[model samples]
Target: MPPSPVVPCHSPVPDPSLYEPINTLKPVVPDVWIADGPVVRMAMPCGLSMPFTTRMTIVRLRDGGLWCHSPIAPDDALFAAIDALGPVRDLVSPNQLHYAHIAAWKRRYPHAVARASPGVSERAAAQDIEARFDAAFDDAAPSPWPGEIDPLLFRGSRAFGEVVFFHRASATLVLADLIENFEKEKLTRGMRAVARLGGVLDPDGKAPLDMRMTFTDRGAARDCLRQLLAWKPQRVLLAHGRWYERDGVEQLQRAFRWLE
Candidate 1:
């Protein structure tokens, strides 16, 4: 059942303390504020990379609850910071590979609804991760973020499926693993070599070759890309790399050009 629970190849968990916090008051995207919530980033060691930065987009909903997207390892200090914003209502695992920290955040906020994308539950089960997903993202926007954020299911990648979001107020497109923009300077020598081979390093971020090759149905991928283009988001945020602060729509087009 459930395709025998396909485990993601890139899933790994290290000490949360290994992460160096980069929380700031300023908006990550120019003038795109999320109430009083701050976008916190943390660098974690994994694979060939000595350390890679992951960003968590915290948005305050109309009901005074925090919606955390692609959450990173939550330490006590991070918890305090999150508490200052409001009660945590939603903890999102944007893709299969990013669910390692979902359980941790849920433990901290018992009332928070942890939502995962398609293929996450099985992968977590296969990997022995105790992730209890209260809900799963589909094509529809979640009730808490209605009209504010839109979710698009990235299809055709037999490796796994991921949900991409477009934040309307900020005109920001949020993605996990669909495209990467790692700055060469931030990667160690070994990681630089590995990233180069993976074809995910910057200038123009593109999907990894392995992932691109997994898509047997090109039509589905292209359809998702077309919908993304229609959203016209001004900024694009990637989970594992530098985000595009300007011309988000154009950047997305360039990144997914291979799908065409």
Candidate 2:
């Protein structure tokens, strides 16, 4: 038989709205506020109207400079708001799949370093997206988070390339779509049904999908889950769902029940 045809997986090109500047900011939780002033955190209603809330973390550097992670596209008003924070210093596309507005942000913050994800270079190139990251995550290496944060690559599995981050000072664990916890009522009708059928939702909220279907090796995934359990975080922040305030470690364990 002839060699199997190579099926190219193209990177998704986000819509124009993704780059639009933030017009308002709101606090979804105490201490954790959404900067909609020039950068809004939009709730992405995906999968049968299931609302997956995404956030853009904007920080004002000590040197009167600003930095943003998972930035949206630039708007004149949003640029002004970002300018007020300080000069743009860095733009981070934290994961390969989260590079929607990276190109626009890079254009606006020309002086800012664009930190790309591990597989971004090849994936972006395939889509003709000319963006690059200054640093990439190494599964075995330590993260350079200015001594304030640490990152660990949840390797041993090929289903998803996830690098979980830990903010030391705040004792916050940031996850990138590895887990979710939104209530079904908060989602659209279609999404609610899907969540119900998937057994990802309960009266309290939706849980993370086991996602074992995507894993190339179950053993590897199980090992990574074990490592995550060892972290013992106080608070868990998910990229696609509600944040876990207390007893985060238990919640994590419950979400990954398949590994047990």
Q: In TM-score terms, which candidate is top?
A: 1
lDDT of 1: 0.74
What shift in Å separates residue 159 of candidate 1 from its native position after superposition? Answer: 2.2
Q: What are the lDDT figures for the candidates, one per model?
A: 0.74, 0.59
Backbone clash count for every predicted candidate, in the order shown: 0, 5
The segments of candidate 2 whose C-alpha lies over 4 angstroms from its true place after superposition are: 1-51, 59-67, 73-78, 86-88, 127-130, 198-210
TM-score of each: 0.81, 0.70
Q: Which stretches of candidate 1 lie over 4 Å from their true place?
A: 1-20, 23-26, 29-51, 140-144
Model 2 CA RMSD to the hidden true structure, in angstroms: 13.4
**Candidate 1 structure quality by residue, lDDT tens digits, 111-144:** 9999988888998999898897899876664544
lDDT of 1 at 112: 96
| Number of the predicted model whose lDDT against the real structure is largest | 1
When summed lDDT is taken over every stretch of 10 residues in candidate 2, the lowest stretch is 36-45
